[model samples]
Target: MPARILFIDDDPAGREVALFNLRKAGHEVTSAADGREGLAAFAAAPFDLVITDLKMPGIPGMEVLRKVRAHSPEVPVLVITAFGNVETAVAAMREGAYDFIGKPFHREQLLLSVGKALERRRLAAEVRDLRVRASGVGREIVCASDAMRRLLTIADRVAATDATVLITGESGTGKEVIARRIHVRSPRAEGPFVAVNCAAIPGELLESELFGHARGAFTGAVRDRAGRFRQASGGTLFLDEVAEIPAALQGKLLRALQEKTVDAVGADAPVPVDARIVAATNRDLPERIRAGAFREDLYYRLNVVDLHVPPLRERPADVAPLARRFISELAPGREIAVPPEVTAELERRPWPGNVRELRNACERMVVLCRGDAVSLEELPPLPRAAGERGGEEAQDWPPLPAEGFSLVDLEKRVIERALRLTGGNITQAAAYLRIPRHILVYRLEKYGIRRDG
Candidate 1:
C-alpha cells in the first residue's frame, strides 16, 4: 500500500535523491533539511515512515528517533548512517528505528526496508481490527460522546507506554474492553491477554490464582499451574475489581508489582515475570483506603495512570449508538431498524447499569420487536418504570412547610442525602444529583460538609 513518507538529511543531494525515488515508487514524500525540521514536520502531520540521517548539523538522528518514538511509538523510523557506521545504525534500531540504511545505499535496499516497515504497520492495524471483531457483543467500546472521545484519546496515548493503568467507573461500564484495546494497540499485541477478576475468586485462592501454584501446593493443586501473571507473558494482565483484593494479599501484590516477580504457592524461589498491569474497579479506593479496607501503597502501585469511564447516564450521546450496535450484533442476519422515537427514549432514560444494561435492553428489543423497526413499547419494562419513577419523584416533591421554609437548609439537606446515599463518594453523589462534580464540590465546601469517608 502507498504511504506518506518523511525523508530527512542535511545533504541536499542525498535528500533530493531519496525524495525522487520514494515519490517515483508512488509514495507521498516530505523532505526535511535536518533533524529539527524533520521532527517539526512529523509533529505537524502524520507519516507512516520516517527516514532521518544519523549525523545531522543541530539535532542528531538518535534524538529524532527517540522523539518520534515518544510521540508515536507505532510509526516506524529508518535511520540513515554513513558508510561503515553499521554500529551506530544498530544503536538507532535499539532506540526504536525500524531499519537503517548505509549512506551510499542501493535504491532497492531502501525500498525493501520501507516496504517491510509499511507492511508491518498494515499488519498491526489488521490485528487490532480483527481482535475487536472477534470479541463478541458488549466487548466493543462506542465513544460517541465527547467525554468518551477524550478518554479514548488519553487511552491511545498511554497505550504506547508500559505504564500500570487503573480504570475506575461504575460496574458494567466496559473497563475490560478498554484494557483489551490497550493491549491490542500496544507492542505486546501479539502476546496473550490474561484477565483475572479479583473479586470473584475467594481470598484463600486469590494468591494462587494470581501467582500460580506448584504441584501439591494445596488440596486442589493436582498439577502445577502457571497463574495469570505467567499466562500474560509479554502481554497485559488485567486485574478486574482490583480493589476487592484482600488486605493480606495487598502487600504481596505490591511486592510483585515493584519487583516484577512472583512467588508461587509452595515455590521456593521467586519467578520473574514480564506482564504489563492494568487494573479496574468500581469502588472508591480512597474511601476504602481511609476505611482501612485497601492499602495506600498498593493503590499507588496499581494507579500509575488513571482512566475514568463516565457512566451511561452522564454520556447520553452514547446511548443511541451503543443501543444500535448492540441491536445489530444481537440480531445478526436481519435488517432491524431502531426508530427515532425509540432512540430518543433510550437517550432520555438514566442507564444506571451503564453499557451492560443498554446492551441487555437492546437484546430484548431485538428479540421482542414485532415490526422491522423497534417501537418505544419494545423497551424493557423495568427501565421504563425506573425512568417514570424518577420523573414522578421529581414532580412529586414533599409539600413545603406550611409557614416558611429555608431553601438553603433544604438544599443542604438534599446534598447531604445524596452524599449519604452514595457513601460520601463525591463523583457518585454529583451524578445522583444530576450536577457536575465540581459544582457538587463547591456545594460541599460552601456547606462545610465532611466529605472524608
Candidate 2:
C-alpha cells in the first residue's frame, strides 16, 4: 500500500532524490530542509514513515529519531548515514529506528526498506486486532444514572484522541471499567490494554516493574524484562491507584509522560512508548500534593481529561439494575428473580463500599436464596446494623473494672483481636479496622505485637 512518508535532509540533492523517487512510486512524500523543519511537519500531522539524514544542522537525525519514536513509536523511522558512520546508525536502530541506509544508497534499496517497513506495520496491526478480539477486553458498561451516562459520553468523545485521562472516584466505583470502555471505543481498540495497580506493588519494586530491568540489574533480576510502558506500546495503560506512586519516581514518571519514553534500569537508551495513559486514583491528589505526598506537575500532566465516577450511593437509580446485572452474571444459566422489594432494600442501603459491596451482596443472595426468586429476608443486613443494635433496645455496656482498665492495653487487645481474626494478615487487618496498613504496622510496632500472631 502507498504510505505517507516524511523526508528530512540538510542537503538539497538528498531531498530532490527522495522526493523524485518516493513520489514516482506513488507514495506521498513531505520534504524538510533540516531536522527542525521535519519535526515541525511531523507534529502538524501523522505519517507512516520518517526518513532523515544522520548529519544535519540545527537538529541531527538521531534527535529526530528519538522525537519521532517518542511521539509515535509505531511509525517506522529510517536513517541515512555517512559510509563510516554505520555505527551511529546502528545505535539509532537500538533507539528504535526501523532501519538505516549508508550514504550513496540506490533508489531501489530505499524503496525496498520502505516497503518492508510498511509491510511490518500492516502485520503488527493485524496481530493487535486479533489479540483484542480473542481477549474480549471490550467490556459492556452497565449504568442507568444520568450522571453516569453523561460521564460515559464525555469519555467516548475523548477516546478519539491521544489525550491523557485521570479517573477519580471512591474505591469500588468501577473507575477501571470506565477506562476499559474508553479503550474499547478508541482508535487503538485493537492494541493491548495493560493495567497496573500502583498500590498493590511495593515502592521499591514499582520502578523496575514499570520501566523494566536489564538482566542482573538488581539482586533478583534474572532476565531482561519489558516494562509496563513498553509492553503497552501502541495501546492503552491504565494505572490504578496512581496516587500511590512514590515521590521519588514521580519525576521519572512525569518525564515519561512528557517525552513518551522510559529509561529502563541499567539500560543505555530511553525506549520510546506509544501507550495512552489512563490513570485512576481514589485518593484526592490535590490533598496529597498539599501534604507533600504527590507532585503537582505530575498531577497536571495526568489531569488533562479528568473523569470522576460517583459512588454507588450517589447514583441510587443505578443500584437495582446493577444488582440485577450482578445476579445474572453470578447465576449464569439459572433464571434468578430479584423481586421489587428486594431491589428496594438494596437501593435503600447506603453502599459505602460502592458497586463492589453490592456485587458481593448479590452473590450472597444468589447462593443462599431458595428456588429461583429472591426474597426480602435474603438481602444483606443494612449498613452498620443500626436498627438492630441501636435506640431503646440497645444492650447495656460492660461495667468498668473497680481499678479501671488501661486504655493502652484495651487498644492493644483490639489490634491483636483484629490480627487474629484476619489470620495475621496486615492488609486484611487494616481493612477490617478501616485504617491504612502503615498505621496498623505502626500500632503493631508500638505495642510490640507479633505480626503473624
Candidate 3:
C-alpha cells in the first residue's frame, strides 16, 4: 500500500531526488530542508514513516530521532547516514531508529525498507487490538461530584494524545484507577496496560525490576528476562508510588524517558521501548525535588499532563454511588439495600482512607448483614476526629466524662486517628497533627502501631 512519508535532508539535491522517486512510487511525500522543519511538519499531521539524513544544520538526525521516539514511538524512523558509518547506524538503531541506509542509496532500497517497516507496524497493531478485545477489561467511574466530572473530562481529552501523564493524590484516592481509565480511553486502548508499584519494590533491586536484567546479572539472575518497559511495549506503563523511586536510579529513569530506550542490567545494548509513561504518586514530588531526591528534568518529562484526583472527603457526592457499586460487587447475585442512616453516617464521617476505605466498609457490611438491608449497626466504627468530645458539638471541647480519660491513652488514640486519616503516611499525618514526622514515628513505635495498618 502507498504510505504518507516525511523526507528530511539538508542537501536540496538529495532531498529532491528522494522526494521525486517517492512520489513516482505512488506515495504521498512531504519534504523538509532540515530536522526542525521535519519535526514541525510531523507535528502538524501524522505520517506513516520518517526519513532523515544523519547530519543536519539545525538539529542533528540523532537528536531528532530521540525526540520522535519520545513523542510518538509507534512511528518508524529511517536514518540516512554516510557511506562508512555502519557503527553510527547501529548506534541509531539502539536509540530507537527503525532502520538506517547509507547515503547514495538506490530507489529500490528505500522502497523495500519502507515497505517492511510499515508491514511490521501493521502486524503489531493488529495483535495489540486482538489482545485488548480478548481481555474485555471495563470499569465505570461512578461519580456525581462536579470535581470528579471535571477530572474525567480532562482525562478523556488528554487520552487522545501521546503525552506522558502524571497523576497526583493522597494515598487510597484511586490514582491507579484514574490511570487505568486514561489508558482505556486512549488511542493505545488496544495495547497492554502494565502497572508496577515503585514503592513495593526495594530500592536496591528497582533498577533491574524496571529495566530488566540479563542472565547472571545478579544473585538470582538465572536467565534473561524482559522487564516492565519491554512488557508494556506499544502500550501504557503505570508507575504507582513513583515518588518512592530511589535517588540513585533517578538519572537512569530520566535517560530512559528522554531516549525511549532502556539498558538492561548486564546487557551490552540498550533496548528500544515504546511504552507511554503514566506515573502516579501520593507524595509531594516538588518537595522531593527541593530536598534533592528527585530529578527536576524527569519531573518535567513525566508531568507533560498532570491529573490530580480529589479525596473522598472533598467529593462527598460520590460516596453513595461508590457505596452502592461496592455493595453490588460484594454481593453479585443478591439484592441488598443500604439504609438511609447508614449512608448518612458514611457521609458524616471523614474518610481518611478515601475510596479504598469506603470499599472496605461496604465489604464488611455485606458480610455481616443478616437481612436484606444494611443498618447503622453493621457499619464499622468511624475514625475519631481530633479535638472532639463524646456526644458533643465542636464548641464543647474537652468534655471529660465522670470517669476521666488518661492523658497517655488520649494521646495514643489521637495519634492512631491521625495515622488512619493520612493512610499511614507519617509525613502527612504529622503535618495534620502539627508535629514533626520524627515525633509521629516515635509515637507509632511507642504505641506499637503498624505503619501498614
Candidate 4:
C-alpha cells in the first residue's frame, strides 16, 4: 500500500524536493511550511508518517513531537536536522521520534528511512490483527431496543478510529460484551482482544499482571512473563472493573496511557506498546474520585469516549429476546419454549443482575422445565414487590424481635435482600432501598458484599 506522508519543512526548496521524491516513489505526500501547519494538517486528517524539520521558526520539531505523542502516540514521527546536529536528533529519538535524517541527505536515504518506518507500522498492525483472530476474541452483539440500537450505532462509529472508550453500567449489564463488539467492528478487528478484570486479580499482583515482569522480579519469579499490555499490543485491551484498580497502580496506568509504554517489573527501561484501551466499570467512578480512591486524571484519560449501557429493566423490550437467546445457548438440543407468561414475569422484576441474571434464570428454566412450554412454577421466585401474591400479601419481611433487633443487622439484611432481588446491581439495589448509589456502595464494602455475589 502507498503510505501517506506529511512533510513539514520551513525551507521551501528542501520541502519541494522531498515532496517530489516521495510522490515519484509512489507515495501520497502533503507538505506543510512549519510545525504549526503540520499539526493543523495532522489534526484535520492523520497521516501514516510525519516528517518535520528539526529547526522551525515557530513550534520546533521537538514541540511538534511532544504534541503528537501526547495526542496520538501511535503515529510515527521522523525529524530532519542539519549536519553536526546528531545529538539533537538523538534527543528527538528519546522523546519518541521514530528516526531522523540530515538536511543534505540523498534521495535514497530519505526513501530508505521512510520505507523502514512505514514497514514497521504495517507489520505491527498485521501482528495485532492476527493475534486477535487466532485467539477468537470476538462475538456478535445481541440488542433489540431502540436505546440499545442507538448505543450500537455509536459504538460502530467510534470503532473505526483509535479513540479510547470507557464503558459504564451496572454489573451484568454486558459492558465487556459491548467492548468486544466495538473491537470486532474496528479497523484493528484482526488484532488481538485481551481482557483483564481489575477486580479479579489481587491488588499486589495487578501491576505485574498488567505490565509483565522479568525473571525473579518477585518471590514466585519462575521466568520472564509478558504482561497484558504487551500481550495486547496492536490490539485492544479491555480493562473490566477499572474502578477497582488500587490507588498505587493508577499512576503507572496513567503513564502507560500517556506515553504508550509500560515499565515491566525488574526491567531497565519502558517498553512501547500499541494497543487501544477500552475500559469498563460498574462502580461509580466519580464517587470513588471524591473518596480519593481513583485518580481524577486517569478517569479523564479513560473517559475519552463514554458508552453507558442501559440496564435490562430500563430496556424491557430486550428482555424476552435476550432470555430466548440465553435459553437456546444453554439448552441447544432441547426443544423448549419461553411462554408469554414467563417473558412477562421476567420483565416485571428489577433484574439487578441485568442480562446475566436473566440468562441464568433462562438456563434454570430450560434445565428444569418438565414440558416444551415453560410455566410460572418453573420460574425462580420473584422479588417481593413483583411476586404473584403481591408485596401487600407477602410475609417475606422478618417480624420485629421482642427485644428490639440491631439496626445495623437490619440494615445489612435489607441491603442483602435488595441485592438479591436486583441480582447484585448496586444501582438497582440502591434504588429499591431509596438510598443514594454511593451510600449503597459504602454498605456493600462495609458488609463485604462482593459485587459479583
lDDT of 1 by residue, 1-453 (tens): 789998989999888888888889999999999888999999899899998998999999899999999888879998989888878978888898889888787889989999999999899788776764564312457778999999999998898789999999997688898998888777677678888888656688899999999999989899999989999998889998798788999999999999999999999899999999999989899999999999999989889999999888999998888887888888888889988888988898776667876777788788898778998888875413324446667686645778988899888888886654544556566777886555676688788986531
Best by TM-score: 1
Q: Give Cα-based local distance difference scores for all models.
A: 0.84, 0.86, 0.86, 0.86
Residue by residue across 1-453, what tens digits does model 2's lDDT show? 789999999989877987899999999999999999999999998899999998999999999999999878788999999888868988999999999987888999999999999998889778766776677877777899999999999999999788999999987788999999889777788788999988767788889989999999889899999999999998899998899898999999999999999999988889899999999988889999999999999999999999999998899999999988999999989999888888888888877667877887788789897798988878766534324555543564333578888888877877886665554556557778997655677788888998534
Provide backbone clash counts, one per model: 0, 0, 0, 6
Candidate 3 per-residue lDDT, tens place, 130-187, comes to 7665766435689999999999999988987889999999877888888888888787
- TM per candidate comes to 0.68, 0.63, 0.62, 0.62
Query: Which 10 residues in a row give candidate 3 its minimum summed lDDT?
Result: 382-391
lDDT measured at residue 14 in model 4 versus the true structure, 0 to 100: 90
User: Candidate 4, residues 1-453: lDDT per residue as tens digits?
Assistant: 689889999998998899999999999999999999999999998689999898999899999989988876667899999999989999999999999999887999999999989988888778766776676777666778999999999999999789999999988888988999898878668778899988767778899999999998889988998999999988899999898798999999999999999999999899999999999988789999999999999999999999999988899999988888888888878878888888888889787688878876786688788778788887777655556554653765566768887889888877887777776666667777987565677678888876534
- The TM-score of candidate 4 is 0.62
Q: What is the lDDT of residue 229 in candidate 2?
A: 95
| Candidate 2 global TM-score | 0.63
Model 4 residue 263 lDDT score = 97
lDDT winner between candidates 1 and 2: 2
How accurate locally is residue 396 in candidate 1, as Cα lDDT from 0 to 100? 64
The Cα RMSD of model 4 versus the native structure comes to 9.3
lDDT score of model 4? 0.86
Model 1 regions more than 4 Å off: 1-138, 383-453
Residue pairs in clash, model 3: none
